[model samples]
Target: MQYVRLGKTGLNVSPVAFGGIPIQRGTAEDTKAIVDKMEELGMNYIDTARGYTVSEEYLGAALQGRRERFILATKSMVRDCSGMKKEVDVSLEKLRTDYIDLYQIHNIKTADFEQVFGEEGAYKALLEARHEGKIGHIGITAHSIDDLKTILSEHADQIETIMFPFNLVEIQGEAALKEAKAKDIGTIAMKPLAGGNLEDWRLALRFVALSGTCDISIPGMGDVEEVEKNASVCCDLSPLTEEERTEIERLRKELGNQFCRRCGYCAPCTVGIDIPTNFVFANYLRKYGLADWAKDRYASLKVNASDCIQCGVCEERCPYDLPIMDMLKKVEEDFAR
Candidate 1:
C-alpha cells in the first residue's frame, strides 16, 4: 500500500485509515490489538472524537508505547474558546498524548460559522494550541455540503483539513469536496460505508480508496479482523469491476433517499429531539445488531424518536428529503419491539 499526501499538510496517510467510533463497543485491550494490526499494516491514521465515550481513552491505552507510529486525530463539539480549550486538554490527556496530529472542530454547522471564527471562539483556542505545539494542525468536520462550501469559500485558509460524508449514497458534497481539494485542504470521508448501511464492505472500502475526491476514507473498524479487512482494500487499489459498479448503482437506488447522513441540519426539532441521532441509534439497533448498546444509548437520550410530535418541520430542513417524522415513528416502533 502506498501513502497519500493529506493535501498540503505534509503528512502521508493510509488510504483507508482507522475510524474510532466503533471502539466504544470494544475494550481497551481490543483497541490495543487493533492498533497493533494497523501499525503492522501501515494504516497509521487514527481519528476519534471527544464525544465517543471511551474511544479516546482506549486509543490512549493502546498507543501508550508507540504513539509516534501513527497520526492521531480527534475532534470536539465545544464552540467557545474556554470550553474548547478545556476540551482539547481533556482529549490530549485521554489520548495519552501531549501533541495531537490534527484536532478538529467536530460536526460544525453553517449556523456556527460566526461564533466558531469570531473572537473568543473555538478557532482561537485551536490556534493557541497550535502555537503552543499541543497540536500539529486544525481542521473542521461538517455534514452539510452548504457548510462545506462556506468553509472553502470563506475560511479555507483557517483549517488544514475537512471531513464530511462522502459515500455511494451521500455524494451530495462532491462539488464542495472537489473545491476543498483544489484549495489543498485535506479531505476526509467520515462515513465511507454509509454509516454501516452498506453491506458490501470490500466494495465500499474500494470505492473510497480509489475515489479521487477524498485523500482518505475512514470506515469504522470494531476489532482487528475489521481493521485487516479494511486494510486489504488498500492493496487491491484496482479499478471497480463491472459487477461492483452495478452493485453500487443498485445500492444507490435502494438507499439514496431514505438513509440519514447524520448531518444534524434538522435541528431545533420543536420537541428537543436530535433527529439524526435517533436514526443513528436505530441503525445500530437494526442493521448492526448492536441491540443492547444501541438501546442503552437510545435510553440515555433525553429525547427519543417516540418524542417526535409529527411535526414536518425537520423534513423541510433536511437536504436529502428524508421522511423524518415517518422514519422517527419507525425508529420508535423498532425500539419498542
Candidate 2:
C-alpha cells in the first residue's frame, strides 16, 4: 500500500485514515482495540478533535505505547490567541503527545477570518506552537465551499492543510478542493460518508480516494471492523469503474433532494439560526444514534430550529432549493423527542 503525501506538509499518510468522532460513543478499551487494528493494517494517520468530547483523550490512551507509529492530528474551535494557545496545550495533554502532526481550526467560517488570522488571533498562537515544536503544521476545516475558496485565495500561505466534506453526494467543495491541491495545500476529506447518510462504505470511500480532489479521506470509525474496512480502501485508489460511477450517480439522485450537504448556501436565518449546522447535529442524532452528543451540540446553537421564522429567504439562496423551513421543523421535532 503506497502512502500519500499531505500537501506541502510533507507528511505521508494513508489515504483512508481514522476519524475520531465515533470514539466518543465507545470506551477507552474499544478505542485501543481499533487502534491496534489500524496499526496492524498500517493506517498511519489518526484525526481527532477537541470538540469531539473525549475523542482525543480516548485516542491518546489508545496510542500510549505506539504514538510514534502514527501521524496524529486534532483540531479545536478556539478563535483567539490565548484561547488557541491553551487549546493546543490541552490537545497535547489529551492526545498524550508532546507534538501534533497537524492542528486545524475546526469548522471555520467566513466571519471567523478576522479573529483567526488577526494580530492576536488563533493563527498567531499556531505559529508560536509551530516555532515551539508543539505542532508540526497548521490547517483549517470548513463546511462551506465559499469559505474553502477564501482560505485557498487568502490564507493558503498560512496553513498546510484544509479539511472539508467530500463524498459523492456532497461535492459542492470539489472545485475549491482541487484548487487547494493546485496550491500545494493538503486536502483532507472530513465526511466521506456524508455523516452516515451513505450506507455503502466501499463506494463512499472509493469515490473520495479516486476523486483527485482530496489527498486523504477520514471516515469516522467506531470499531475494528470499520477501521479494517476503511483501511482496505487505501490499497486501491484506482479510478472508479464505470459501474461504480453509475452507482454513485444513482445514490446522489436518490439522496440529493432530502440530504443537507452543509454547503452553507442557506445562511442568515430569519431567527439567527445556523441552517447547515442544525442539519449536521440532526444527522448525528438520528443517523449515528448519538442522541446525547447531537442534542448537546444542537443546544449550543444560539438559535434553535424551533425558532425558524419560515420566511423562505434561506430557501431562495439555496442552490439545491431544499425545503429549509420544513427541514428546520423536522430538526426541531427530532430534538424535541
Instruction: Name the top lDDT candidate.
Output: 1
* CA lDDT of every candidate: 0.90, 0.89
lDDT of 1 at 139: 97
Q: Could you give candidate 1's per-residue lDDT for residues 1-337 as a string of tens digits?
A: 6999998787999999999988998898999999999999999999999988999999999999899999999999999999999999999999999999999999888899899999999999999999999999999998777788888889999999999988877788888888889999999998898877787889988887777889999998899999999999889998999999999999888775578866456787998998878888988898677999999999999989988888799998775668888899999999999
The TM-score, computed over Cα atoms with residue i paired to residue i, of candidate 2 is: 0.82
| Local accuracy of candidate 2 as per-residue lDDT tens digits, 212-331 | 999999998899999878899877777888999999999888777367755455776778898988888988898677999998889888888999877999997774567889999999
Worst 10 residues of 2 by lDDT: 257-266
Off by over 4 Å in 1: 261-308, 311-321, 330-337
The TM-scores of all predictions, comma-separated, are 0.85, 0.82
Alpha-carbon deviation at 292 in model 2, angstroms: 24
